[model samples]
Target: MILKDIRNIYHSELDALFGKEEVDSFFNVLIEHYLNLKRIHLVLDPQYMITKEEEQPLFEALTHLKSQKPIQYILGETEFYGLPFKVNEHTLIPRPETEELVDWIINCHTERSQIVSKEPQTKILDIGTGTGCIAISLAKHLLNTKVSALDVSEEALVIAQQNAELNVVNVEFIHDDILNSRQTELVSVFHKYDVIVSNPPYVRNLEKAEIQPNVLDNEPHLALFVDDENPLQFYKAICEFAQINLKANGMLYFEINEYLGAEMIALLEGYGFKNIELKKDLYGKDRMVKGVK
Candidate 1:
């Protein structure tokens, strides 16, 4: 069958669900991934043909996409901070807002110092790391620094570990829960960090209606939501952990819910974190917060 026919079928089936442009994007990406054929290839050879076996994965992915599954999960991978990461139901797909958070950290760290440490190198920790995107990206950018990531789910940790290896960045992956008192104690004893960052479960149950079906139905809720009445539960826990584990003059960061900027500032203040800064993302939503211990 002509590959153009497949492309047309994609638009016929998915254009309404994802829009024409996104369907084209998906079809192009799928053909490239499964067939090693770029969009230009289709333009150059409109009658491109493939074996029936070559059609299997594309059709399977189309079936999942029709059900509103995220393309990242359907592809079993995504790009975060310009690095490749494997993702699954166990891990949350890294978002553009989170990439902004990473850029802020990278810029801040890069600008803060140029003199490599004569003593202990800077240590950074990412709590609730799903795919190790934050920690690994930091390690990849920051030189002579030690990076570590912690997550409760072992399944997520497995993917994260693979990503650490895939990125060729050494990230100490810890299997522990930040919200659990015993595990937090053990984790704190392992190392005090110069920087601690987290993009924890901040979305509240009330916000579920705002989420798309692709995310609500397919993504990991354990990495996404909090109770509406106590939406800051994870933030509060991580803050408490940082209080005990963050070194003096150390920095802390969070990718936050857009609506809770004021509350986040107050939370950081109450935890005695100084010089707190709330930052907006590309769309100008208050989506990141940073503070000094």
Candidate 2:
């Protein structure tokens, strides 16, 4: 069958749900993933043909897309910070705003890579490291850094470990709930670190309406939400942990809820973290915050 007809079917079915531009992007990604053909190949060969067997995956993906499943999960892989990662239902898909947070960390530490310091090794930890995107991206870009990531879900950790291996970056994966303070072994893992970063569950239940169906329906809720009554529960725990675990002048970063930026600032200040910075993403939303210990 001519692939063009399949492309038309995609437009007719998905245009109302995802719009023309997004449908085009999805079709392009699907064709590349299933048919091993690029959009350029399609443009150059409008008559390109695929056997029935070659077309099955594309149709299956279309069915999933109709249900608002994320394309990245359907593909089982995504690119973050110019590196590839494996993603699934157990792991939240890495976001562009999180990429901004990773970029901030890399830029802040890029000088450390140049310094020939015989002092203690630079260590960094990522809490709630779904897909291990932040930890692995840092390990790939920053030199001479020991990176560790922790998550409550063993299934998410499995995917995170696979992503670490996929990206060829070394990351220590910990399977423990950050919110559980009673675990003795969990405390032992919090050695002094040069940096502690997190993009924890910051979304309040009230904000669910703001979330698109694609995410609210498909992504892991454990990684995406917190009780509206205690929206800052993860942040509070990480803050207290950083106060004890960070080295002198160590840095702490978080991707935060935009609506709670002022509250975040107050929370960090109350925890005695200094040099707090609330930065906006490309969308100009207060998306990330940083503090110094």
Candidate 3:
């Protein structure tokens, strides 16, 4: 079938599941993912055809979309900070909001270099570094930063290591549960860091009803949720780690739950962190918090 015909069918079929607007955009993006064609080509060459061979995967992708599976998972990879990273059920698909958190870290590094007169080589640690998106992106962009990442899941760390190699950036990936404070060990070579960043699991189980089924059912729950009994459990544990692990005047950054922004700020303040800042995402939702140790 011609590319145009396939897209038309895809749109109609997906529109029945997702809405017209979503299916239209989703089909175009997925086509680009599989074929490497630009959006303009997709529009101009609707009759552009795909073989029956290609149609099988396309059909499977459409079925997954109908089931509300995220397109990133369907593609088996995603672009973050302008770099390709592999992803699947093992990790959360890196979101644009987390990109903002990364940008803040880069800017902080730049500003510090200006003040210090020497180009500072920073020691940086990423906790819960699923798929290594945050750590790899930082290492790719932040020249002279010694980067390391930690995650509890060995399977997730495997994907994260592959992404680090794929991006051609050097990062030490350590497998350790951050929740287990006694067992969470830093790499001896890169011990204390000027910045510690985490986009840890902040979603409360009670909020699962509000999340899309694909995420709740397919994405790794160990990476997506916190105990409902104490929603800020990870935050508290990370803050405690930061207190002892961060250098004097070091910074800690977090991608937080929007509803828990004030609570997070209070939590950090309780830990004696100063210069606490709460920032919002593109959607104006509270999404990030930064504090000085």
Q: RMSD of model 1, in Å?
A: 1.1
Cα-based lDDT at residue 156, candidate 2: 94
Clashing residue pairs for model 3: 2-48, 2-49, 3-48, 3-49, 4-46
**Model 2 spans > 4 angstroms off:** 112-119, 184-190
Query: What is the C-alpha lDDT profile of model 2 across 1-293, one tens digit per residue?
Result: 89999999999999999899999999998888887788999889999899999889989999999999999999999999899999999999999999999999998877655564654568999999999999999999887789998899999999999888888889988888777776524544657889999999988999999999999999999889989899999999888888878888999999999999999999999999999999999999999999999
State model 2's lDDT: 0.90
The candidate maximizing TM-score is 1
lDDT for model 1 comes to: 0.92
Measured against the true structure, the TM-scores of the candidates, in listed sequence, are 0.98, 0.96, 0.93
Q: Which should have the higher TM-score, number 1 or number 3?
A: 1
Q: lDDT of each prediction vs. the true structure?
A: 0.92, 0.90, 0.88
Which of 1 and 2 is the better model by TM-score? Answer: 1
How close to the true structure is residue 91 of candidate 1, measured as C-alpha lDDT? 97
The candidate that wins on lDDT is: 1
